[model samples]
Target: MWQQSQAGWQTDTGAGSVMQHRLRGLSGKLLWLTMAFVMLAEVLIFVPSVASMRLRWLEDRLNTAAAAGVVIDGLQPAELPRAVQDDTLMATGTKAIALRKDGTSRLLAADHMPPQVDAKYDLSDVPAFQSIGDALYTLLFGGDRMLRVYGPIGDSDMIIELVMEEKGLRQAMLAYAQSVFSVSLMISLITASLIYIAINRMMIRPMRRLTHSMQVFAENPEDPARILPPAPGNDEIALAGRHLALMQEQLQKTLKQQRNLADLGLAVSKINHDMRNILASAQLMSDRLVDVDDPMVKGFAPKLVRTIDRAVGYTSEVLAYGQASEAEPKRRRFRLAELCQEVRDILAIAPDSGIDFVDSVAADIEVDADSEQLFRVVHNICRNAVQALANHRLDDPGALRRITLSAQRIGSVVAIAIDDTGPGLAPKARENLFTAFRGSARSGGIGLGLAIARELVLAHGGTIALVEKPGPGTLFRIEIPDRPVALGDWRVRA
Candidate 1:
């Protein structure tokens, strides 16, 4: 007997290993689709196995009846001749019989049928046939016993049939199918578990360690805390960890350098205060030199006076630089062209150093700025250019030592460009050009001139930048907003 239960076809309700593996790593939709495909495959294999079992049962019944000397008449089975009856019964195993003319059935020997055979196996209404003048027939049907073979006998007009049950074949197929499904499910669970554990250990744990290290470093940069564990082999993760360690070390070095600069600034601030007072006294003494009458005194006295004036100005700037505080700009309208010429005259590199300072400023150009602060900005940039040219001229006396200062109106702003014939800034210097002491040329004294120049220009709501030229030398540009000013309003008090 076959037992039917809905439980055999029930879907899995609990999340099994496959489902858990997918939840941890694979996409949910793909996992579900794969499971559905697995179930469909199982059904396809099981259904075919069941159908084949039933087909084999039918074949067995037909072969048995032929061997037992039974005769078939349409859908009925009949007794065989006594000569072949024993052999036929042994081969067929079961039998049924039916009348040929009217297609009716009568049981010739009930003992010949398989046990548990039901009415579902009956085939009395099927067509009849004649074989070897025997008026034979055979009807084949499938039910719980899986197959029925029926026919009629020729001589006695008796009917016969043979039945073969599929229960054993069905049970065997079901057991094999269950074994296959269990093995597949177990493999999926094991694979998923291994993948989950491997990912958590190798990837997730390392990432967590890196994150923790970064958090600790952010709180205290100087703390010697390890963020990355050293891997034994050379891999991408190991390379990244080494790089991170190097960056941390470099950052610590930079911080120490900055601290040293701060301490130097503090010591210089005190010395600068005292130096300013000494320069003030020198300025007063130089004022007395202007009154000397000798030709030698007259010739060199003015130079001495100018030198002292520049020293006093430099002292004031040094004190300001060390204090790290900016004085508010005393902004007023001024003729930009006049300031350019003043810087050119002060540098005085013409006949002496073979360096030419040329100005190309338009007559009507005016700008809003603090006269003294703007003067410092222009003076520092121009002095640097002059010094660079002088250094280059010393190397090659025939080299053109030219410094060109030009100013022009650009929309609502004025742009001033000072170009010099000197070796252009090195690649390393150019990169850190504006970062306090970081961008200084190795040959120059600390590189504060350009730095202070940029600071003073920025204080006036203007901008200064280093421009690269195709050939040799450097070009520095300063841009300031253009504002209209009355001619008299542009005067500076002595």
Candidate 2:
């Protein structure tokens, strides 16, 4: 009972809004539309009815006048009394009645001279719209003014005319309009109620359910219970609910994965803090191996030292790069060719390494970039190419093993292409090409080099992409442009 009362109040509140605010809710809009359409329909029906009412009223007057004319014409002239004439005029509801017979005007009844006809209507052959328009005109503006109506009387060679007042026609029209309005009001209420109920059940309720689900989901998205339950139909609302549920499920799963990655990063930070000191101590011990005298120890000492140095460098880089974001670069101009030489020299290519390093940049070409970040970007690519070339292990005499670094300055941008003549990347590595810990091509590589290189390159507002050719090697293209020149102190220039 309370729910029913609340619904009634809601309906009344929606309906009782001022005209300016009436069309607010779903129910209110439906009600207004229904009333408008029903009233329009009633108006359509009322005009013709008023027009028809006038037509019938005029016909009855003409018929009564004709009947009176027949009765008076049948009587002798001496027997026609003034009282009978007055009675006939009153019965016909006209000031006068006349019959035109054989080209002669014969008055059946007339108590006085009929007033001048304000309007004339020929009932026998009038167009429909004109008749309707004239009827409306009389109802709106015609007071007690007189009207003349004429029509053929049966098969005789005579026409009947009646002069009557417009008041009766107007009054009848008002009554007819009142009747139509009452019925239209009832129909509007019933139709709007049915349509409002049907549409609310079909659409509004479902939309409300989805809206509530989204609000709850937004408050605490990780709670699985907040997801919307799928509705049970093949309609658009049901489909939308299902798609929303699936999106919430996928988002929850992604949030879980992100939380796990954050926890792992915290754990790795703790381990790296202690591991750095231990690796430092190991490095000191490994340096002492230089003074050992054993032959096997001398043979393996260099390789072991290099491996530990690489391990220490890897740890420091991984920890620094694991920061929330890479630090912004300090920009400066530097020699590109000189930087490439430093990277190649650091790799320390042996005479029998079977890999050729070709640097083709111009000696004087310079780039505006961060020295440390650009060095890492170039070094990582060159080192990866060197390692890839060494991995080929060409025992056959004629196999080509080459890593080439070439560059060109194109207008405002410098385009550098790194080409290698070694084995290309596998499909999985190409798919996750620049992603961290995923684009690994070598065993035990951690896959952070290219990812970090891409990150640093992006920080300089440049792009790095791989270009593939028909040969065995993979090509990486890097383009870095100079920063925009800032306009300073226009007053001084002026």
Candidate 3:
């Protein structure tokens, strides 16, 4: 049983060995991916932005020089102020050129001038007089390397060309890029760490709690209730946690109920052995009732005898249902509708109760089941529904007292649904509906009807569930597998 319970977990975890052994959960991978994407985007945007800003600053400085009466021809090496000359000489040292108003140009600062610049200068004829204006020409040559800014001095015949080296601007941009890259990397690392921690706390932790609780429950089913904590909000994960917790609570309650039922079954097995003898004696006495001439005795004797017989049969069935362990299903292909009718007839519901039994199974449909055991399963459910209706009628006399049994074949499964128009099971009862004594409420009868029904269905490799009913009615559904089985294969081997 433990192996069977652990199989699903093993299958899920086995597929991702790395995930299982290294990273605790998928959140770690997600955090890393998020951080990587953020860092990449920051690098892409920040590098270009810093470069553009530096180029704009250099252009502003050149315009300032031009505005201060720096002309191409008159602005000779000696005529320039020491501060301006020194700054310009140092600034343009990497890639500077001095252009004269006579269309003459000299390389004052560059170690090497690119071929495109000399060719373009000759082609455009180096404008004799250029106006210094607010509008600056911004151009990029060969993949954002070279930025050229050209303008004229106010009312001057000389065009002042200050060739600023891109290498320095490139270096400044590189330094800024490095700083941005470092900061972005740090931010990404921090963000990823925070995301990993937050996700683990908010999502993974609760899931682990749920998984651990389930493992514990599976190991020792008799252990006390251990429920997962409620999620903090109404998000989908929180809702899933809530639902999982509810399901665990229900399962825990069910296991407890089954434990109680096992105990009850043990006790009932002993009592049943003794009760059968007493019932046998009573059957002999009942046989003698036919000889009694009193009309009152005649009318009531059969019912009393039948009731006692049914009680004896019910006791025997309880023992069989509880004690059997993995016995082969005593399956036989039989008409389901006929079996339902048989169960209704055997219950012998009272006329004054005004209870009605309606069967809706198709006539031609058949199912494979252990006739005796399957009969007990159906009889118990139908009897319970009838009893519920009878109980309701005692209170609200006008209430509809009907129990409807419907069966249909859906795919390879045959479903039988029993609905009763009674005050549906109480919330507490519903919570532990199929749990042995746990299903009982204020009005109770050992709470074994549904439990026994479920066990019997499971014995035949089938399922029994409580269907959701809207109001004032209980709906129970039993689904049996439709596969045909040989009688020899189904019978008890011993």
Candidate 4:
């Protein structure tokens, strides 16, 4: 997971570096995109601008030709001189100018007018799209074409027509286009620069800092110093920083726990070897004590033997616990009531400890489980309750100090609950109730009892939990289900 994160960060980092990577990086890409959109907006304005310019140019020529034709029309039958006519046509920038009144066409001026114009336009009511298209066509390919333009003479009945070469108009349009492009290019650069700077400061820089922090944190997650300090703000960047900090804290704690477990496993490995030898020797000595005929010794010898046997088994389990593995339960059908009695015996709470052990399991109730593992699970919880009650009774002598063990067969599962009436679990212990080392509230206690108990219960494909119950003390429920019966066995039983 961290490798993928680092790779992604590196890719983004590379994108910020050189020209090749710049286009791929967030900052550079946004810069280019800003420029592109601004330029595109300018293009939209440019189209209408050039079209409007073209319309104005044609309107001016029409007005000039109409004024000249009106003056010449009043001089009926008196023709103007050829040189004057040619000068009038030149002034209007046209090859010919004519006036039409009541279907009668009259030539007002002529200067080598074309036999037929290449294109004709009735500009009095041209559509917007057609006018734009015509303007663009003139700019692109109008240099060599001849145009005949006709329009009404300002609400008058007469219409004025002019034949003109498009080359001059094309030249004007090209110059105007050049000016527009220069200004548009400048505006686009300015706009794009502003947008790029704003986005870079607001988003890109923060993201880069986040990625860099992640890379550093991933390198040594166990180091609490490497955790990110959450950035201040309500924005996503700040939120992400806060979450990352939280995640780092949790990961650091988990890593620390794992490291402690590893060291513990190693320590146990060395200690158990010698510890086993000592316990084995004690076991042999206790076995010989059974032969003593003293009444008290006879009664206590069996209990001592059972205690040593349990201790030996516990040592092996502790060694296994350190290695983060355990033997699978050696499951068998057994009476659960008998197992509860055994846990009570193993704890052997003093009668005057001000603690009472209540066994509420029915004698007939049976469970399918590893007897020894189930014993550990119950004994560990019952023992903790005994300790808690023993301590609580000293502070509050009148307080009810009791641990209750209850079991029942519910369908194919057996539910066992251990409730105590001393004091409930501390807030911190409850939070890490089944977590080794951190779960212990008592000083000098490494909380492996509940952790190991939970592990053993889960090994039987069961669930164990600290349940909320009214009144004082802690209540733990363990549910172990019966293994699935084989089809062949069921058929035989049927």
The C-alpha lDDT values of all candidates are 0.64, 0.82, 0.67, 0.89
lDDT of 3: 0.67
Ranking by TM-score: 4, 2, 1, 3
Candidate 2, superposed: residue stretches over 4 Å from native: 1-24, 67-96, 110-134, 137-148, 154-157, 165-167, 186-210, 223-325, 328-368, 379-451, 471-473, 481-494
Better of 2 and 4 by TM-score: 4
Candidate 2 or 1, higher TM-score: 2
- What TM-score, computed on C-alpha atoms, does each candidate reach? 0.53, 0.63, 0.50, 0.90
Runs in model 1 with CA error above 4 Å?
A: 1-174, 189-330, 341-356, 359-364, 393-395, 441-452, 455-463, 468-471, 483-494
Question: For residues 1-494, what per-residue lDDT tens digits would candidate 4 score against the true structure?
Answer: 99999999998877656656645799888988899999999999999999999999999999999999999999988999999998998899999999999999999888886877899988799889999999999998789999999999998899999999999899999999999999999999999989988988888888888888899989988888899888889998889889989999999988888888888888888998899999999999999999999999998898899889988987777666656578989999999998888788878788877788899999999899999889988988888888877666345567677889998888999999999986788898989889888898354579988898999999999999999998878899999999999999999999
lDDT of 4: 0.89
The top-ranked prediction according to TM-score is: 4
Question: lDDT tens string, model 3, 180-258?
Answer: 7788999889888888888878887766766777787678655555576676788777788788778877787777767
lDDT of 2: 0.82
Using lDDT as the measure, the top candidate is: 4
Residue-level lDDT tens digits of model 1 in 63-118: 45543333333324444455444444445554442232335544433334455554
Cα distance off (Å), candidate 2, residue 256: 5.5
